[model samples]
Target: MLRLLINIFFLSLVQGSVAGSEPYFSLADYDAASDREYIGAVGILSRPDLGLVITITVQSGGALLLGDPPVDKIPSTAVKRAVCGQVISFPNLPERNLVCR
Candidate 1:
């Protein structure tokens, strides 16, 4: 019972650390030649769901500054990474045929 309590305490601390960290979003494109994902755009948002409530557009092929309006918010449901040519679906959004450079 003591060991179990210790394990739970450790897990809580780890979760707290993760929750305290800032969240950011990035866009990646698939490189066909190398068959790898390359980060194209990165942005830090005030909240994950801020994009859902506001118009936040990220133009590809460029890096966003920390305070840029475009990077101020991101979709809460955005994935960390996705494979090219794969179908992606999100809540309240229709499925899309994802194709990246």
Candidate 2:
């Protein structure tokens, strides 16, 4: 019974961490977008303990880059180790379903 209780406690911690690790952001549709208009919906940056949020920006002509500051256009292979996810939303347009992956 003691072992079962310990297992349950560890399982809860794992479940909580997984659920909290999801990265969310509302990227701008245009380069001219202001900081106020661009929203990191999850506000992950402030929580450094969560690790760096790898932002893959989808640009015109279907280009992807690290969207975060000192934004660079590089191969995704370089950032394979970073924990990342995408939050797709039309913040400037009509409301639609939010997609996270």
Q: What is the clash count for each candidate, in the order shown?
A: 0, 0
Clashing pairs in 2: none
Cα error of candidate 2 at position 78, Å: 5.5
For candidate 2, write residues 11-77 as lDDT tens digits: 3332122222223222324343433333322222211454333323443322233334313222232
Error of 2 at 57 (Å): 3.6
Tens-place lDDT digits, model 1, residues 10-99:
233221122212234223342335422222322222223322111112333322212223333232222223222333332343333343
Which residue pairs in candidate 1 collide? none
Backbone clash total for model 1 is 0
Single out the weakest 10-residue window by summed lDDT for candidate 1.
13-22
For model 2, what is the alpha-carbon lDDT of residue 19?
Answer: 21
